[model samples]
Structures are given as structure tokens and as C-alpha cells.
Target: MTVRLRPTLAALPAYVPGKSVPGSIKLASNENSYGPLPHVLERIAAAAENVNRYPDTNSSELMDALAAKFGIGSDRLVVGCGSVSLCQQLVFATADEGDEVVFGWRSFEAYPIISAIAGATAVKVPLDGQTHDLRAMAAAVTDRTRLVFVCNPNNPTGTAVSGAALLRFLDEVPSDVLVVLDEAYHEFVTDPSVVDGTTLLERYPNVIVLRTFSKAYGLAGLRIGYGIAADPAITMAVRQTQVPFAVTQIAQVAALASLEPAAERQLAERVAEVTAERGRVTAELRNAGYQVPDSEANFVWLTNGPAEAGGIDATAFAAGCAERGLIVRAFADSGVRVTISNPAENDKFVSAAHELRA
Candidate 1:
């Protein structure tokens, strides 16, 4: 007889990351094309020289920097290799067999994957139009639901929830249920109505706010991110679940140095530049007859629902872009998510879109 196994573990679908091609403009992962400041490079180099020593298991210094930056107490801060890892830790800490994890469909592709890995049932609520339907999401709650993920601006679509709407949603949901406010792209948003997630951590004990250094900070390769919350219990659970010395010594040094004054100014400037570029790209797409919601993130999502543009299917569109030395992320059959990496790549992508027409 064949040996029995944990069916969920054996049968779970694998996570597929965006492709990387040599010498191609890769706008696939929503990473910052603007590299980090010069001082951060020096810090990374210095940390590299100390590779023999293990990283601090608690990552105390980086945690102190993060706490000071966000004004959150150090006790409530949980550092991880990436916010993605924290996402997994959060699920493991709270979810048990038969418990349910909820998230909007087409938000972060990782939500369901993490839920499944944790042995929890993944409940995906469909998007209303192109946005996350908070009312529908709030209504989908059941007694077994222990966690809900809210990614804004929602991944692949780039639509963010309003401050007022989220406040109401929080009030409506059960206070005991943990809500993860994944704001990986929070720095890119220019909308006036969006809530400052860091501030919300002070007001909402149930909310765990996640942020990364990969986007505006241009540290995707470094793999440093953090989770902020008011609840010591949740933060402590995540800290306990994290592997010892999970974050590299280089990552810790680079992240701390990135929080310095000049580095932050550089990030602020880059944020303004990228948001403007995102606006420009969104308008260009809309002018070409594609419907788009206001993108509050660095990437733009193109829909191909019941339609095709000049014989260009969504997959074909992405493939065509790849052929032209551009690597835009394609969400097969759903749409294409194009990252605004830099001016040169953005121009190449725009050229590819226009060229595909002929």
C-alpha cells in the first residue's frame, strides 16, 4: 500500500515568481528601478566583510530603527526576511486545520498559497468590478474565519481602499479576527483618501501592517521587511515562528542605513517620479481604449475580458513584450501587470504596445 501523507502539503500548488531575463528591462516584480543611495552600498559592502558571524537572531538594531521611523514601539514590531515571510508566519501562528483564511481574489496571489500551506481553508471573495468589495468581503465571514488579508492597492489591479471604507469595514468585522493590511506599495500611493497604514496600527489592535524595502527603497535583492501592530501577542507569535537569523547580516545593515535622512529623501523623490510615470502610463493605456482604475501603485493592470486588442491576446501581449526586450508580468487570461521600472523600460513597453497594434 502507498504511504499516507498530509494531502494538503502534497497537493498544494506551487508559487510562481515573475520571470527574469538577461539584458531585458524587467518591470515584472514591481521593484524600484532607481537603485539605493551610495551610503547603503557602503553598508552592504561592510556587512559582506563580516559574513563569518551569524546575523542577530532578534535583529534588534534594525527593529529599533524601524520602530523609530514608524513611531511604533519596538515590542510590537516583528521583522522578517520579507513581508511575504511574515505573511506565512502570521498564518501559522493563528490558523489551525479547518480554520478559514479570507482574501479578495486577484489581490496578492500569495494569500491563498499561504493559507493552504498553513492547512487552512482559503476563502477567495471575487472582486466587485475592478476593486475589492469590502461589503461582500465583510459578509463572507464565518465562525471559522480567523484571518483576512486586505492588500491595497490590490496587487495586479492597483486599486486601493479608502480610509473611510476601511474604518467601516473594521467596525463591521469581528474584533477577534486578525486582519492583515498588506501595504507593500504604500509609499507609491498619491491618493488623498488612502489611510496611512502605520498610523492605523495605533488605532486598530487587530490590524497587522506589513511594509517592504523592495519598492521605493530599491532593495528587493536585500529581502528586508517588517510587520507593525499594537498587539504584543500577535507580534510575539510571529517572532517565535520566524527561523533564527532568518534575515542576513547584510540585509540588516543595508535596511538600517536606508532609513537615514539622505536615503529617505532619495526614496521620497523616487516615489514622486514613479507615481508621475504611473499616471502617465495609465493615461496612455486609457487613451488607447483600455479601462483602468486609478492605480495607486507602481504597476498597471490591463484587462482582456471578453476582448482582444488588434489580435493581441493577454498572453500574446506579454510574450510580444518579452520578444521586444521588455519583461512585463502577465497574469494569463486575467490581464497583464506592467511595472513602471524606469523611463527607458517604460518607453520600451509603450513602444511595444503601439507596435503590437500593427
Candidate 2:
């Protein structure tokens, strides 16, 4: 007899990471170009000495650090291998067959995948323009909805919804349903109107905030991220779903070192640089006649091409950039997301964009 697998796996699409071409400037993945500070590197190297021992599955020291940093009880936190892993854990913890998970259509690609893995239906609400239509999302929520993910500064688009609209949406959602604020790009957000997800935890007991060391903290390879759960029950559920000792000791040490005051100050300056480059890139794309969205994160979103180019779609634009030794992430029939790197790298992208437009 042939071996059988879960039938749902057939419909699930494999996640495609950004392409890497030798000698090309890759602006496809939304990663920090900077590396960890010298002190943090030293800690990570030192921690590597204890690799023979399994990591603290509870991650006690790291948990305490995060709890104190956010002024939250240790019981309300869960650290995962990465925020992406936590996303899956949240779905597994809450959803089951016949239940539903809701998120914006183009927000995070993994939302639907994770929901499907949990044997739950994925209910995607389309975006209004480049941003999430909160009213539409609120309307789409049914009694069967178990979790809702709001990816502020959405991926592949770089658009963020305002705080007021988010608050209204939260109020509309049923208190029993969990609303996840995926703030992987939190450090790069410069908008005052964009609500910090952590600030909403106390008032909204159903809220969970996911942040990462991958972006501004410059530890993408280390893969340490955390979730702030307003409810201890939710925290417990997410923690229970974690892979045993998935987080390594090196990752824990590097993350803790990154949280130190000196390291954080330096990282903040680096983030400021990225945001400034983001502004420059957005303006340059606009000047080249590309339809660019206002981005609060460390990247810019390019929609339809200039009218002069017969309104080319993202794929075509991405191909043009690739030919010019630049790699950017493109969504089929949607748009392109270009990461903001250092000034020189941003200039190369701008130059390529201008050439493509012309």
C-alpha cells in the first residue's frame, strides 16, 4: 500500500524565499544590512562554548530581560525560535478544524499557510488601496473566527494603518478572539500615528504582540523572536507548542546582548539611517513616476509602473531590476518591496529605477 499524508498538504504552497544571485545587490528580503555590535558578537562567541548543553527550554534569563524591558510579568511572555514560528504556534494553540483565522489578504504570506496547517479555514480580507481595510476585516469576522493577525507596516507593501482605525477594529473584534499585532518591523516605524502593539496589551487582554531580533537588532541568522501575550492562558498555550529547545544558547546570548543599553542605542542610530534611506528611496521612485506608497518601515513599495511604460506590473519591474544587478521582492499582479540599505546601495537602486522608467 502507498503511504498517505494529510490531504490538506496538497493545497499548501511552499514558501519561496527571496532569490540570491552572485554579485547582485539583494534588496528582496527585509533584513538589516548591519551586523551585531562587537560586544554582542563576543557574547555570542562565548555562548557557543556551551553548545553541548541544550538551551534552557524556558529561556528564563531572556524571558526575564524581556519582561523587565516591557514592564510585564514573566508569565505573559513566550519566546519562540522566531516570530514566524510563534505565528504558527498561535494558530495551532487556538484554531482547529472548522474554525477560521482572519488576516489581510496580502499582509503576511504565512498566515494562510499556518491556518491551513491547523486544519482551519483562512479568511483573507482584501486591502483597500495598499493598506488593510479595517472595517472590511471587522465585518468578515464570524463567530468561528479564532485568531486575527494585523501586520502593521504590512509585508511586500510597506503600508501601515493608523492607530485610530486599529483601535476601532480591535473594539469590533470579539473579546474571545485573539488579535496578533505582527510588528517585525517595529523598530523602523517612524510614524506617531502607528500604534506600538505592546502599548495595547493591558487594555486588550486578547492581544498578542510579536517582535523580532531579525530586523533592527541585526540577528536574522540567529533567529530569536518573542511574543507578548496579554493573557497568561494564551502565553501558556503558545509556550506549550514550542519545539523543545528550538532556541539555541548562542541565539539567546546574542539577543540578550542586543537588549543592552549601549547596543540598543547603536541599533537605534542604525535604524534611523535605514529610515532616512527609505525616505530617499520612496522620493526617488516617485520622481521616476512610479506609484510608491508611504512606508513607515525600512522599505518602500512600488505599485504600477510609470504611465510612460504602459503601467508595467511588479514582475516586469523586478525583472528589469534583476537585469541591472538588483534584486527586489515582487508580488504577482501586485507590487514590489525594496529594502532600504546603506546610502550607496540605495543610490544604485534609484539609478536602476530611473533607467527602467526611462
Candidate 3:
């Protein structure tokens, strides 16, 4: 007889990752088009020699580096496999069965999935325009709310909420609830008014700021990210839930190497290039008559669905781009998200979009 799994587990929606088609320019995932820096690669290579030994379970050196960089005490930080893993850990740490985890509907696909896995109820507030509706999210919180995720420069949409709006939302949230500011794409953010989650930690004891080495640091394959909290107890709870040896030795060393001045300068240059390309691509798409949102991240959003383009859905648009050796993320009937890469790659995607319109 088949073993019975929990009904919730059986029904959980699988996380859909961006497609990687061989020989195609993949603008589906918002990864830094540029790969890891030379120094980071060198450190990773050095770390490889010690593979026989298990990784430092605590990722002590990496944690120390992060603590120094953020000017926070080591006790207040928890490094994990990735920001996504920390998202799960947060849910497990605070939410129990029947408790609620609130977030924006299309913010991050992982929020709802992680909440469901933890047996917590998922409460998704709809976006205002293409950005987060912080007020609506604040209103959604009830006594049963244990956690909330606010994806700044939200994934797939690439729209960010103003710093003032976020502060207002924080003021309204209850002190007991844990609010996570998921800033996976923080490095790519160019907006001056966007809330830097780290800046608010001192003021909000319940706030947790999540950052990743995946995007701008170009270490997506290494799977290392961290969460910062003013409360050491909250960090402890997240640490307790993490899988042992989750952060690899190579990932730890590479992350440390990335903090070096030269490597940081190089990464900053790459970010500048991506940000410039983002503006160019957005302008081009707008000129092409698509309703593209103002993107602060390394991607652009096309919110007009099938009806906007004489009944051409996001899936069809994606498929057309695929035929032309370009891959972009499409959300069922909702919209399309295309990553801004180097100029040549962005040109290919732009050409694909123009062809699809024809």
C-alpha cells in the first residue's frame, strides 16, 4: 500500500524556475549576466581542495564578513543555503498550523509555497499598480498573522515601493509579527527612495532583512544568502531551523572573497552596466508600444496580458521569443518578465519582442 502523505504536501504547487534552453539567450531568470569575478573564482578553486572536509556548519567566516559589512553584530545574522531557504526557515520559526503568512500575490513565487510547506495559511494581498500595496498588506494582518514577506523591487514585476510607504507600513504592523524584507535583487536596485531593509532594523526589532549573493555577486550556483535581524533571538530561531552544512565551504570562501575592495569595484561596474541596459531596454519597449513598468532591478515587466495585444497571451509571447533563441519568464495569463543582460543580449531580446509584435 502507498504511504499516505499529508494532504497539504500533496497539493502544494511546485516552484516554477526559469527555463534554460540550450543555445538560447536566457533572460528568464534575473541572474547577473556577468559571471563571478576573478578573485571569487580563485577563492572557490582554492576551497575545492578541502572538499574532503565537511563545510563549517556555522559558516563562521562568512557570517563574520557579513556582520562587518552590515555593521551588525554576528549574533544578529543567520546565513543559509539561499534567501529562499531562509524564507522557509522564517515560516517554520514563527508560523504553526492555521497561522497566517502574508505577502503580495505576485511578489515572490516562493512565499506562498514556503508558507504552505510550513502548514501556515497564505494571505496574498494584490499589488497596487505594479508595485506592492503596503497598506493593503498591513490591513490583511490579523491576530493569527505570524509572518509577512515584503519583496522590495519585487521579483517578476521589478517594481519597488517607496521608502516612505514602507515606513508607514512598518508603523502599522504589530510588534509581535515578524516582517521579512526580501531584497534578493537589492544590488540591482537604483532607486534612491527604495527602503534599504538594513537601515530599518535598528528601529524595528521584529524586522528581518534578507539579502543574497546570487544576483549581483554572481554566485547563484553557490546558494549562499543571509538574513539580518536586530533581535538575536530571532536570528537564533532561524539558525535552529537551517539544514546542517547547507552553506558549502566554497560558497563561504567565495562570498568572503567578493567582499574585497577590487572585487566589489568590479561587481559595482557590472551593476552599473546592467542598470544602464535596463533603462535602454525599458525605453525601447515603451517606444515599441508595450506597457513596460519602470524597473529598478535588472529586469523589465510587461503587465499587459493577452487582451492588450489582440489576444496574445504571455505564454505565446514567451514561446515566440523561444523560437528566436530567447527565453523570458511568463506568468500564465498575467504578464512577462525579461532580464536585462549585456547590450548584445538585450538587443537579441528586443529584436525578439519587435518580431513578436509583427
Candidate 4:
């Protein structure tokens, strides 16, 4: 036995993050156009003086603050470098060799790859009409399935399942099979039917809500995020599995300050702006000969399909847009996924769409 590793880890592809160009407007990664608060920057600057010291190994202060804010106990929550890291940890905790992880195809790109890395089989259910079909996803479950990830306002597609449908699906899934509701974009949703992960967690014991400060909080550079779970076992495993002092001191301070009532109020206004822009920009794209979907997240989904659900491919179209200086994500043969940034940049995207379509 020379060097045999886990087959799943050996076979999985590394995650490809959106590339950053020097002068190009990056709409590829779903980052907030608005920078972090001036106060957060100040806190970071102050913390930089203590670079020689290790971070709080337990992140006691940050966890306590999050628990109080979310109305969950400390035992129910765990923080990570980012929500993506929390995702990898969740798979490690719940899934074992030969276990299954179910999710919608073309949803979050990381779900399948991370599932494989955790020694679990990834069961990718195809999306129905660019949305997560709750019934179909729920039905895909087998006894071997250990975890199910529901990306609310599912990434790339930006379509979400209705609250009623989600409630029903939760009831149908096995209580033992952990259902991780990835609500990374929950801050930008404007629709009434969409489920709020914080509120939903009160009703579902097995549910683990994953959130990030990278998006609406405008702390992408800090890479701070957390998981909200009801059980102590999961949280304990996560706290132990994580490397010592992972979340930096500055991140803890910034995140805690951002959770203040005043900051939340400000965040609400920013969310309103994004929601409005998403509607406006999506309509403009549709008017410009693009087949856009009814996106409820802080992004829009466009298809160069329908006329040829087999005709002009979306990846090719995305590549064309990249050539024009606007970076958009193309999901293979499926449509393109554009993450909505700020109002000014959205206008630029709309202008680019008109130029390309015209």
C-alpha cells in the first residue's frame, strides 16, 4: 500500500472561485458592491496591532453574541472562517463513507464536490423550471441519504422554493437526516413567500441554517460566517473539528458590531435597494431578448435557452459577456447566473445586456 487515499477525496475536483481581473467589474462572485462599514474598518485597523497574539481559541465572545441575537443557545451555534467552511464541516459531521447528500443540480457548485470530499455520494436532482422542486427533492431521499442541502434562493439560479412547500418538505424528510438550509442570500430576498431561516429554525429541530457576512454584511474579505443548529451534538463536533483560533480577533469584533440593532437597520435599507434593483435589472434584461427567470434572491437567472433549450449555449454566451468586460457565471449547458451587486454596477450590467442583445 504505497499511498492510497479516500477515493472520494482523490477523485473530487478543487473548487474554482470566480477569477478577479485588474480592471474588469467582477459580477461573477456574489459579493456586495458596498464595502464594509467604516466602523468595521476601524475595528480591523485597531486589531491589526495584536498580530503576534493568537485569536480567541474558542471565539467565546462572537458565539455568545450570535446566540443571543438569533435567540438560540450557545450550544446550537458554531462560527467558521466562512459559511463555505461551515458547509465542509457539516458534511464531515453528518456524512460518512457511502452515505448520500442530496441537492438540486446546478444549485450551489460546492454542494456536490464538498459532499464527495466528506466521503458521501452526491445525489444531484435536476431543477424543475429553474427552481428547486420540493416534492422531487424530497422524493429523491433514500435510506443511505444522511444530509440534504436546500439552497434557499438557490445560488446561480436565484430561484427559491415557497415557504409552504419547504414546510411540507421538512416534514417529509427523515428527522435523523440533517437538512442544511443554506441561506447565504437571505438578506436580499423581498418576497413574502420565501422562508426566513432564523424564524424557520424554531420549528425544525434537525435544521441547520448557514449564513455569511460575506454578502449583505459586506465583510467578504474577513470571511466570517456561522451555522445555526438546534442540536448540541452537531455544534460540538464543529467546534472541535475546527482548527484552533480560526476566526481572527478582528472578524469577531466586526461581526459583533455589525449585529447591533443600528447596523441591522442599516442592512435593511441596503437590502431594500438590492431587491428593487434586482427587479428592475431583471425586467430590463428580459426586455433585451434574454429569457430571465423570476429570481427572489439578490441576483437574476438568464437563459439563452427555450428558443433552443438546445440552441445557443449559455456558457458560450457567458464567455461572450466576459469578452465584453462583464463577468457572468454560466452553468454548463444551462443558463447564465448573474449576482446582483450595487445599483450603479447593475445599471452597467443592464447597459451591457442591451448592447449584447441589440
Residue runs of model 2 more than 4 Å from their true location after superposition: 305-311
Candidate 4 runs further than 4 Å off: 1-6, 306-312
RMSD versus native structure for model 4: 2.0
Q: What is the Å distance of residue 268 in model 3 from its true position? A: 0.9
Cα lDDT tens digits, model 1, 1-358, are 9888877877786777889999988878898888877899998998999999999988899999988887778999998988999999999998998999989988888888889988899999999866899988999889999999999889988999999999988888898899999999999989999997777766789999999987878888989899989998889999989999999989999999999988888889889999999988878776666666789999998876643541236798888989999888887757788898777778778878877755
The C-alpha stretches of model 3 lying farther than 4 A from their native spots are 306-312
Q: Write down the lDDT of every candidate, Cα atoms only.
A: 0.86, 0.90, 0.90, 0.83
lDDT tens digits by residue: candidate 2, 1-358:
9799999999986787788899999999887888888899899889989999999999899999999999989999999998999999999999999899999978778898888889999999999988999999999999999999999989868889999999999999999999999999989889999999889888999999999999899898999999997899999999888889999889999999999988889998999899988988888887878888899888888876556743557898899999999999988767888889989989999999889877
- Point out the higher-scoring one by TM-score: 1 or 2: 2
| lDDT for model 3 | 0.90
Return the TM-score for candidate 1, rounded to 2 decimals. 0.96
Residue-by-residue lDDT tens digits, candidate 3, 1-358: 9998899987798999999989999998888878899878888999999999999999898888888888878999999998999999999999999999999978788988989999999998988878899999999999999999999989879999999999999999999999999999998888899878899998999999999999999999999899999999999999999888999999999989998888889989999999999999998887777888888888998875544653347888888999999999999757899988989999998888888777
Q: List the residue pairs that clash in candidate 2.
A: none
